[model samples]
Target: MKSSRSITTILLVTLFLAFFLGSASAQEPVELQWLLIKFWPEYDDPSLLVIIDGELATPGSELRIPLPADAELNAVATAESSGRLLVNDWREETTADGKRILVFSPQFPVFRVEYYTPLAINGDQRIVDFELPAGYLSTNEANIEALLPPSSKDIELDPPADEQGPTQDEVHLFQRTVGEVKDQAIRQKITYVNASGALTVPETASSSGALLQPTPPPAEETQDKTATGITGNPWILLLGVAALLLIVGGAVGLWLTRETDENEALPAASPAPKIKRKKRSASTTIRASQSNLDRYCRNCGREFGPDDRYCRYCGAKRQTVP
Candidate 1:
């Protein structure tokens, strides 16, 4: 029972250490802001940006935009642009040391949206559609048409002081900690410094290009999809057999591996015993004549033990010496 308890204790300590090893954060707070193109109406219109941290919006970080009269408000989250944004889901994250990360979509580069379902905008019937690859800024950076395909302008793009972007791995992980924040415009400052020097360029609404429109993709000169031999392609039976064989081989390999691991993990055999040899030992001592109380009787050579005052053999006497 003691040994079993000891094992359990060791396992618990190991599991505890492992748990803390992967915890997302152990230090102080971190704040992150993601630019959302919330209400872009023009091609090069300035984008709306939001900085989200937990559930609390940073002070003085609301978006400054003029909402049009009768414009239906709808927000569609997508993943497309840069091929890293989420088509639907957006998320936020942290590291073991607690560094915060916000992910955006890469597929839905530009997600066009209306706030209220079956919504309309600018007297135009806005289509509530979903595509892929847009980042946190899709709705906030409303006038993204300037960066759209027809324009793919040679506009000089200088990365943020710390240049980061959405990747295909995923985006929007921050939402995990951010919780639910919808349609509320949180205020924040967009600080931009001048390139040449001295002059600080204030962040004004981007008013540049035209609102991007959807262009039908070019017609594909497709190879003959007309099945030359098999209509539904029954020759694929051979491919199916090959795939089955591969699966079987993989299963066998996995089974063998499990068996090998089980064998290896079995408790090691008990240790062999150690043999030992022994040898006899001896000792000696001396006493004074006055202290010879334990001496034998000299007359008969019989032993005079401590209990006897005189020798039992031949009646030899014993005298006290002080």
Candidate 2:
């Protein structure tokens, strides 16, 4: 009986160990490629932009990131390869330890989170105490960049930056890089004195407008359709005018051809009347000769006898003197 009890206890322990190992293997943390944190005071209030670029072992999985309890979320988005930002849906949750976290299921691997937090300001000095919590993620690399105000002087950073220089935009920058960030939170403290209290960007340009929001991707199809609509109307109008002109020309041509055919199909006009000449009869000619008495002989210049039918001197026929 003692041997059987020992065997049973060993079997139970083995089973418990197998279950624990399986659970541990299933809850593996998501791996991040890089994390970029930027602190800028260009807006009406100081802001933080956190860009998380990572690949998910399982696509469409839930992701959670921890933030300060007092932080107010301004925007959350997923970035495309084309650098266009698409808005993402998220919700806020409170942890058991009284900390706040952002909860969302990301369909894509890369996402961005931005928020506004309180900046400690006293007189002409400003203070920023920023923290990045490692709730359930790990990263191979991390970068932090902070922009100082335009007229800031005597700038200071705790855990001093690795480099200090002016950025391409001519703004003073404090930069730091970390390797193999895992299972630990990152903290930074920056202080500066700005007697003028000027911001990195103008206040009017960043005040509760489009500057505060992420720019949406352009709608190429809609714009193409609008351009087609604008340009297509003139062509349609021109075609209509051309068709009308052709119709008018065809009608006129048909009318002119019909008129020519009608004139050709009619009979020719009648010719004018011609005058005829009358011929004299032989009896009329003999009466006119008998009435005339004065006569001359033919072939001789002599007087003719009465009722002579021939010329006596030359024996030639006498011509009538009619």
- TM value for model 2: 0.53
lDDT of 2 by residue, 50-146 (tens): 3344545465767777777777666676766676666776665553345655666764766777766767888888888877765477777777878
Best by lDDT: 2
Against the true structure, whose TM-score is highest?
Answer: 2
Provide C-alpha RMSD values for all models, in order.
Answer: 19.8, 34.3
lDDT of 1 by residue, 185-253 (tens): 332112221222211112322221133222222223211121222212333433454455555555655
What are the TM-scores, per candidate, against the unseen true structure?
A: 0.21, 0.53
lDDT of 2 at 240: 52
Question: Candidate 2 — what's its lDDT?
Answer: 0.64
Q: Clashing residue pairs in candidate 2, if any? A: none
Query: Candidate 2 regions off by >4 Å?
Result: 1-28, 42-59, 204-322
